[model samples]
Target chain A: MLATVDQHDDTSPEIGGIAVDRLRSIIERVERLEEERKALSGDIKDIFAEAKSAGFDVRTIKQILKLRRLEPSAIEEQETLLDIYRRALGM
Target chain B: MLATVDQHDDTSPEIGGIAVDRLRSIIERVERLEEERKALSGDIKDIFAEAKSAGFDVRTIKQILKLRRLEPSAIEEQETLLDIYRRALGM
Candidate 1:
């Protein structure tokens, strides 16, 4: 029965139909991930704006985001700098 | 004349006036650097848009920019990836 399904080029058997369903599921998963990514992007933008309004440079915020994603340690270094700056400014 | 001017705490000598002028120049230079930074930021945004239109993720572009700023070699790595992707896509 499996051989017969494989032999048919145009209409394969139901058992072989799993591949198509799997492909559809994969595409749907990718679509959902993309949607989630868009939402996260908006949240990041809001954070940048908030930082900018607080007298922080938005470019630095963007850089910090990138650095945080690529190098977690870099973020810690930046936080240390922020702490020092705040202390110096008595903030 | 210089001693007389320096003796007056309120109105310092012309020789001491150079310090005030130097401080003004430093402030002006910083202002110019800030303006240039703003213009460069807009240019980077445009580059991100171009990358997005080319099917590249803007988030990746932002990361690339950050990495490039922090680690110059990272940009080369990204360019290598771009080259491989382009070749694989036959573009």
Candidate 2:
């Protein structure tokens, strides 16, 4: 795969000279990163399944993901809600 | 802006007929949504500044945003850390 990438880089010089090389390098790096991302995603899915098997509230996990996407203040609001929920449960 | 958008839509009908109208509507909707997004972003940033002035750990808020981008299991890990942090601080 690396050899193929290097060969493609060599013959594709007519595309845009050095800029094409740079773009190719960036695209290759991104492709590698995407593969790593997919692997990590699968690992996370497995962990969630494990947690479900262990009887944790999976819905709370989903909520955590949703809250995590918000801005800082929004996250603080979510944390406050979590605190309230924990307190109400005497945990 | 709405008038300009409508005029553009009317003149651009040769681009693709009904599909052009549908595309124009979608683009107009997106433009409006983008304006709303900017307003909301400004509001959230102001809220964060206020929270910082109130002496909250802004890092946690940033972390929350980062975690929110992750999958469910990754979010669960972040919440576990938050739970531990809260308990340690006696909050």
Residues A15-89 of candidate 1: C-alpha lDDT, one tens digit per residue? 332333334456679999999999999998888788889999988777766786866786777777666444433
Identify the leading candidate in terms of TM-score: 2
Give the proportion of true interface contacts each model preserves, from 0 to 1: 0.00, 0.00
Per-residue lDDT over A1-91 for candidate 2, one digit per residue giving the tens place of the 0 to 100 score:
1322344556555332345666778999999999999999999999999988997656666655665568869766756865654455454
The segments of candidate 1 whose C-alpha lies over 4 angstroms from its true place after superposition are A1-18, A64-91, B1-91
TM-score of each: 0.29, 0.43
User: Which tens-of-lDDT digit does each residue in B11-89 have in candidate 1?
Assistant: 4323332333334456679999999999999998898788889999898777766775866676777777666444433
lDDT of 2 by residue, B6-86 (tens): 445555554323446667789999999999999999999998999899975566667555645788796667568657544
Docking class of 2: incorrect
Clashing pairs in 2: A68-B68, A69-B68
